[model samples]
Target: MTDLVQQAGIKLDATASSPEEAVDICGKLLVELGAITSSYADAMWEREQIFPSAIGMGFAIPHGTDESRAHVIFDQLVFVRLAKPISWADDEVTCVLGIASQGDGHVELLGNLAEMIQDEDKLAILQNSDNPEEIAQLLLGND
Candidate 1:
């Protein structure tokens, strides 16, 4: 998972004036890494249209629907920390975590992520870190 994040790319302190731009930043990285097709980004946007991805505490997980799974070539995760918070529906989001998985791994990934963020210290690190590697370590327990 950490390798996927390193390969997919992480953008720290990135500036995006809107939620769409934030999602685009992470999606583009996945596309560049060949983890997903270009259309996957649009799929993410469409999913967002159906329901906001913001999960709370300034974090948002933007992903495509099962129908968009066809665009996924591999399991990948892209983390982006915005330079400023953007409105994702009713929530203010500063971190956009983009996920592209081909199978049930996405469910496991989300489960792990949920557990990780439940720790206040870990959540603080994720919300405040400016180093991509450090953030990855904090999230994936690579440290």
Candidate 2:
């Protein structure tokens, strides 16, 4: 597990209802959590019309790789939770991790994130925690 994923990463909430709603919710969540610009939350909805960033894994990792954000330091892994159930094309994911990354390193970061999710202990811990900080610690404990 990476350090960022443990501290200011995996543990969060958005109270949204769908992947589309999650985009804005996640953006505001980052601002609330003090990790992203206020405008970042609204960025996803605009870009989704071009190419949907919904990646399935009982999770939807949305992002903005659009032209405007091209040169910004967009390396961030944010968390979002639907206030109600949301369906991805592949599966219904209650949890979403919205990544705003602009570097090739995201490939490796994604692999690690997958590994973190796959770990049985980590999975159970995160699944059981209501508090985001505990969830984050559970995710990072493996590291």
Candidate 3:
């Protein structure tokens, strides 16, 4: 998972004015790494059109829908911390966590991430951390 984080790349204090741009930044990295096809990014955007990905508490997990799984080459996560918050539905999002996974594997990853981010202190630490390795460690841990 740490390898996935490293390979997918982490953007701290990224300059994206909107949630779309933020998700795109992370999605493009996954495309560059061949973890997912370009269409997967489109799927994410489409999914957002149907409903916002922002799960609240300043974080948004941008991901493709079930139909878009065909574009995924592997399971991966891309973290992006925006320089400014963007409106995502009813909430404001300053962090975007892009998830790409083949088949049903993402369910578990999403569950774990949800649990991890539920801790306000942990989320605050993640938002403040400047080091990618440290952020990855906080997310992936010793697993």
Candidate 4:
């Protein structure tokens, strides 16, 4: 939990207009939370074109790796909750995970997050939680 807290923060949205809009909104939150550089937001949008971050199961994981950005080892992680469903592939996602990584090390972290996200039980726990800290602890097994 401490590890995730060290890297990511959570933000609330009173109203998230749409799925694409949610991605843009989440990127802004990551920048404002200091989890990622503001410039990296562009890279994230580009990546979204090649691959949809909407991994289904009410989750969307977006990432960006640009040299112009901070390019830190741990990168950054941020959670975004939408007021309504957003189109992703054939599904609608409500929670978004905005991630930014600089090097190969992040692959392992990303894999772990991906696995955790795939688990229906885990995802349920996270969605039902009130804040990111609880979700982080759930993922980190800090509880």
Candidate 5:
């Protein structure tokens, strides 16, 4: 699971004017990590249009559509913390977790994220910590 979120995958001090821009930045990080092709980025935005990804606690997990799975090369997660909050649908979001997975991996990833965010201490680090290693540890656990 640690491999899913390398230090490079964690980006901080980012800025975005809108959800679209935020998603784009997330997609670009996944592409840079060679997790998915460019088309998958568009799919993520499409998914956002049909259903917003903002799950609360200032976080939004965006992923590509099922059809966009063809563009995925491997499972990967990109964490982006914006310098300021952006309006994501009805909620405000400062953290974006960009997911690139081809199969049930995404389900598992979502489950882990759901559970992690439930812990207020961990969620606070993910939201406020500037240290990439700390954020990665929070996401992947003490291991």
Candidate 6:
């Protein structure tokens, strides 16, 4: 979606035993994209401790804390599909949308994500699709 998500950022069949591990993996992707520094991942974990990111519909959006926005180089998103569902706070999450955004960019991203979650057909496709392009298209509202 939006140029923020590249095929490289769409990770499929990734494995993480815990929420922290999943968040760390997401942070690594953001760092690889040059969207954020390493500390931003830690910030995500800290934020998770205070408030879980799980938004139901089998997805969780993880992002840096407000203060950690300093580590952000730009606005970007990394989508991670886990090999197995992991318990995240009160929900079991199979997908993670990691965000590294400056200013209020993340708010818009979250809003878009909320809308996406309400689309059961798209959500179903995202849950089962292994093709990065397909997933990207769905996320971008092109499919």
lDDT tens readout by residue for model 5, 37-97: 9999889999999999999988999999989999999899999999999999889999999
For each candidate, what TM-score against the reference?
0.90, 0.69, 0.90, 0.77, 0.94, 0.93
Each candidate: what lDDT?
0.82, 0.59, 0.80, 0.66, 0.89, 0.87
Give lDDT tens digits, candidate 3, residues 6-81: 6236778888887778878978978877789999988988888888889977889888988999999888888889
Judge candidate 6 at residue 126 and give its lDDT: 79
Q: Between candidates 2 and 5, name the one with more favorable lDDT.
A: 5
Model 6 off-target regions past 4 Å? none
State, as a TM-score between 0 and 1, how close model 6 is to the true structure.
Answer: 0.93
- Arranged by lDDT with the best first, the candidates are 5, 6, 1, 3, 4, 2
lDDT of 4: 0.66
lDDT of 2 by residue, 108-143 (tens): 656766777787766555445567776554434444
In model 3, which regions exceed 4 Å deviation? none
**Model 1, range 1-143, lDDT digits (tens) per residue?**
54657723788888999888888898898998889998887899888889889998788999998899899998888888888898888888988889887777767667767887788888877888767778777656664
Query: For candidate 5, what is the lDDT?
Result: 0.89
TM-score for candidate 1, residues paired by index: 0.90
Q: Candidate 2: lDDT over CA atoms?
A: 0.59
Supply the TM-score for candidate 2: 0.69
Following a full C-alpha superposition, what root-mean-square deviation does model 6 have from the true structure?
A: 1.4
- Choose the strongest candidate by lDDT: 5
lDDT tens digits by residue: candidate 6, 26-139: 999999988899898789999999999998988999998999999999888889999999999989999999988888766765776788878888787778898999887777
Off by over 4 Å in 4: 1-3, 6-8, 12-14, 65-74, 141-143
Best by TM-score: 5
> What is candidate 5's CA lDDT for residue 22?
95
| lDDT value, residue 50 of candidate 2 | 65
Candidate 4 local lDDT, 1-143, one digit each (tens):
24544324665443665655776876776676665666677677777877887876778887774563564334566677676667876778888777766655455655776787777777776676676667766655554
